[model samples]
Target: MIWWAVLGAGLGCYLLKLAGLSVPPAVLAHPVVSRVADLVPVALLAALVTVQVLAAPEGGALALDARVAALAFAVGLLWLRAPFLVVVFGSAAFAALLRLL
Candidate 1:
C-alpha cells in the first residue's frame, strides 16, 4: 500500500512537471511570469533555509539558537561578498564555537 502511494505521488509530480513544460512560450514570456520564474528559486531556497534553521526537533515550535546565529553570521559574510568556501566554513566554525561556549 505504501509503495503504491509512493509510485502514485511520483507519477503525479512527473505529470505536474510535464504540465509546466507544456505551457505556451508566450505565457512564459509574459513580464510577470518571467519575473516570478526568476524569483521563485530564491524564495524557495530562503524558505527552506529558514525552516531548517528555525524548526524545533519535534517540529512543533520555532527555535532560536546557535544555528540561527550561525545563519546570521553566514548572511553577514555573504553581504560582504565573501567566497563560498569561506562562508560555509566560517558559519560552521562559528556554530561550533557558539556551542562550545
Candidate 2:
C-alpha cells in the first residue's frame, strides 16, 4: 500500500511536470491564464507553509512554535523591504535560536 502510494505520488508529479513542458507558451501567455499561472506558485507555497508551520501531528488544531515565530519575523522583514537573503537567513537563525531556548 505504501509502495503504491509512493508510485502514485511519483506519477502525479511527473504528469504535472510533463504538463508544464507540454503546455504551449502562447496559451500560458494569454492574459487571464498568465495571471492565474503567476499566482499558482505563490498560492501553493502559502498552502505548503501553512501546513508545515501550523498542522499538528494528531491533526487536532494548529499551534504556535519557533518555526512560526521565524516565519513571522521573515514576513516582517519582507514588509520592511529587507533583502531576500537577509530575510531568509535571519528567519532561519531566529528559528534555530528559538529552538535552542
C-alpha positional error of residue 21 in candidate 2 after TM-score superposition, expressed in Å: 4.0
TM-score of 2: 0.77
lDDT per residue as tens, model 2, 1-101: 99999999999999999988999888988999989988999999999998988877678888788988999999999999999999999999999999999
Candidate 1 lands at a TM-score of: 0.91
Poorest stretch of ten by lDDT in candidate 1:
56-65
Q: Give lDDT: candidate 2, residue 20.
A: 89
Name the best candidate (by TM-score). Answer: 1
Runs off by more than 4 Å, candidate 2: 20-26
The residue-level lDDT of candidate 1 at 77 comes to 100
- Segments of candidate 1 deviating more than 4 angstroms: none
Candidate 1: lDDT of 12? 100
Return the TM-score for each candidate structure. 0.91, 0.77
Give the worst 10-residue stretch by lDDT in candidate 2: 55-64
